[model samples]
Target chain A: MRVRLRRQATLLATVAGLLLAATPVAQAYEPVNIVHTEKVQAGPYPITVGFSTWPLRAIQSLDFTFAPDGGIEGKSGTLTMTPATRSTESRKRPLVRHPRKLEVWGLDIRALEEQGDWTFRFRLDGPEGPGEGALTLTALEPPGPPMALNWSLSTLPLIGLVAFLAIAWRRTRAEVLAG
Target chain B: MDLTAPGAHGVRAAATPRTAARGMPTAMALLAGSVLGLVGLTWDVQWHTDVGPDTFFTLPHLFIYAGSALSGLAALVAVLGATAAARAGRPLDPTVGGASVGVFGRTFTAPVGYLISGVGAAVFLLYGMWDLWWHGVYGFDAVIDSPPHIGLLLSGIVTMVGTIMVFAAAAEHRWGRVGTDVSIALTAANVTITVLGLTDVGGPVDAVHTAMAWLVVILLLTAAGFRPTRGGAVIMAGWLAVIQAVTWWFSPWAAYAYADAVGLPVRDYINGVPVMPALMPMALIAVALLIEPILKAARAHGNRWLPVAAGAVAGALVAALQGIQDSIVYTYPTPGPGTLLPTAVAGALLGALAGHLGWRFGHMLRLVNRTRPEGN
Candidate 1:
């Protein structure tokens, strides 16, 4: 009887696994979705900036693609992202091959941590020599409720916990001590 | 059943170590959650490495939250039971815990360990909120040393400490030995994880931070040896090795599996070993064995400074082993903006303090049941 039940369970699990495996592919992370683009002429090279999410917001994950005219071949590039908000540090990243796209350089599922204007400075070095250009990106407030409000709502449970501990201790301290 | 545990009459019947230790089962259960969370943390690191920055609601996040929830739930159960026991007009046994602090007009009672664990869970929520905000402001930078991450790791350490204290309080019982030893291993894991954020392995400054963590390990292991039931430190060392093996095996494998299952295969699948706490070589195990003769000598000769000496040795050894480990795994040690001398000095100083504290804490745990409250 136990063996029969075990075999049935195994069969059920396999079916479920197979069903999940057959589900439609989630394009959420694999393919880069270019929702917006900006053009920059780095000396003789004309480079295009592709953003997965337009009107970039702080803390929201998005992808970025930098495709130069003709192709990325015979050309190595570098990216330096500097936020207008001086409070945050600047980041220097090399133009690596995009994971999914494979033809261009991109940052996959990366988020801008702060809301403000950001400068994307690119240096493309290839057969045309080293060409440099910069573009300003304005990142507005993130989607959904304000950050403060979200934090306030998230911390309610912590406050409740503190209050409960206080009340429980107050009512019990006198009674337990005298007992 | 433990002899001193509550009789059939209930928790009110006796003021014994068993009654105090009533929460041992809960504490151990909480440990499972912590271990799960540590696993998730390690897996999460590997995920971030092989895969790029992902959404907040990823599989790793789920595992972390679930583990935190399980730990929080277990601690909450212990607290509620203790408070109910106190409110029912039963004075809590001191060995286990009792009404120690009052909040506003209300006073709650429980074992100190459970109380601290509960507080840790609450603090974790606060850190979670901070982490969310930090991500919004800082973006999804992969480095571990964010303010919120540090806070989260500290809260985790506090939670682990609470577990250790509970077992230490119940040191009289057989359960306490296993509990304390296991707790020691987990705590060491937690401490190492926290230190990793502060230190970059093989870097001059980073190496010192790694070496400084030897203080806690020495203290805990030394404390374990202080118990009537000896060899606990060695057992804890074994647990550390197990932590390394389990994490090393699970992190990369799970990262790949989860990423594949979710339809987002890794961008760069080819990688070196995963970087996480407890994934490194078991340096503490060797240190543990090496210090035994020293600890024994201290006891045998009544030499007060020997434990401190052991701490110093462990400290220096930690620095040396960490350097060697990083050299083998990553690149050769770099002087990255600093020299190695400061690290050596800091390790010795921290080790000396840890040695002294370990002896003190070990003694305290040994005598946990004996030092009852004044009225009790």
Candidate 2:
């Protein structure tokens, strides 16, 4: 009878262990899935650029991750972006940790203002040496209706307000004159 | 101000006075809300500069929305109270301190000021959906001049104007006039700071900004001069300075503490001084000094162009003041004859128009006291 009881306990333990082992590890944050990646050679240092959203759309927010061949250590970098049209000034800033994905340098929920092929220039300083490279990313037109159409729809409130105010004014005046 | 009376169920009320003092709390609430909104804006600028845009529901945004919500809530309370009071056969104008607007063909009456405030609040809140769509299309804005952002800020200014009207109705009271002065100052600072895109270190746009900003200062000053209170415009200018001083301290501290609390590290690069430490036209006292005497002369002699002259001089000086501020703060090319000449030419036109407009608004405010304008 004792042997049977021991056997039952062992069976329960084995089943629990199997279930625990089969289950995936808990995610500490909302996981950022890198949908597409591009390779750029910054001299001696080979870097990988990952985008959370594939078929990048202009003005659409997406997470970007930049990782070297190995882990990021004893390294710093700056990112400069020139728009596709190149009509505006290029934006330059230091590369910082993605607000959500803290382990690597990234831009979280950033978007390209203009559509077409935008250039991203990266200057990296690392333990191995200094390296620089450029990547041209194609940002398709923004999703949904044209922005002009959206603006036309959005401005309906203003028109409604004007009409309402006019009505309110006239009605109030009529009542006052009657009095 | 017993707003808790189970409403009159939509009865029409008279536009007569009940108790002038009862509306004080509501006026105070309006002022506090507008000021809080300004405070939040200052913090927001710092947040954007110190930290990157991570999400929409950041702390600074909450402050801003909360402040606007407070203003909207106050306006709603006033409108409903007045409506209920009117339905109960109580007079509406005294409660609203102005004329009453008949709602639903006089089913409900709303005060002009409170109603305007309510409309502005509704627009601001509703505009958020449009702004959200804009973000979806445009992503995070690299600059503050996004179309939706401009709309949102403009609506808030409308609310600020409503706040001024709320006080303007009760301007007969000493405290009421003081309230008017403070609200005007806040509105001016808000316009100048938020519209900094209109003015920058250099370019022709600065001229445009200078002209508009000059007109705003002159208009508000001229309007305040018509108030019954002595030194009203000067007091407004002093309040502007006070806002500057407070913002210089509050902005940095709020950003640091909030970022620390949230465990979000700030960016390494930041502006040397508080973002908009004293972006307002600080030479307002000088303008007020000239304006008061000019206003007095106009009243005694009825010289119409005196206002134009006052506005023109104030405008030129305003342009000069801006140039000086730029030279001191930024290494932007000093405004030579090239910049100053065109700016002054544009300033004169806008300034003159503002002066005329300011007179009408001020005189209207004076008449609201139910007394002779000159007597006030």
Off by over 4 Å in 2: A1-34, A42-47, A65-78, A87-108, A123-132, A149-179, B1-18, B93-95, B133-143, B196-203, B211-215, B228-230, B276-278, B290-292, B323-341, B368-376
Could you give candidate 2's per-residue lDDT for residues A1-179 as a string of tens digits?
46754775687469547843553342132356899999988877788999988889987777799887876777888888897677774767887776666678787667776789988888888887889998999998888778686556544544654554445344444332222
Q: Lowest-lDDT window of 10 residues in candidate 2 chain A?
A: A170-179
Per-residue lDDT of B204-235 in model 1, one digit per residue for the tens? 44453544456455545455445534455567
Fnat per model, in the order given?
Answer: 0.10, 0.12
User: Fnat for model 2?
Assistant: 0.12
Chain B TM-score against the true chain B, each candidate: 0.84, 0.87
DockQ of each: 0.13, 0.09
Interface RMSD, one decimal, each candidate:
8.1, 7.7
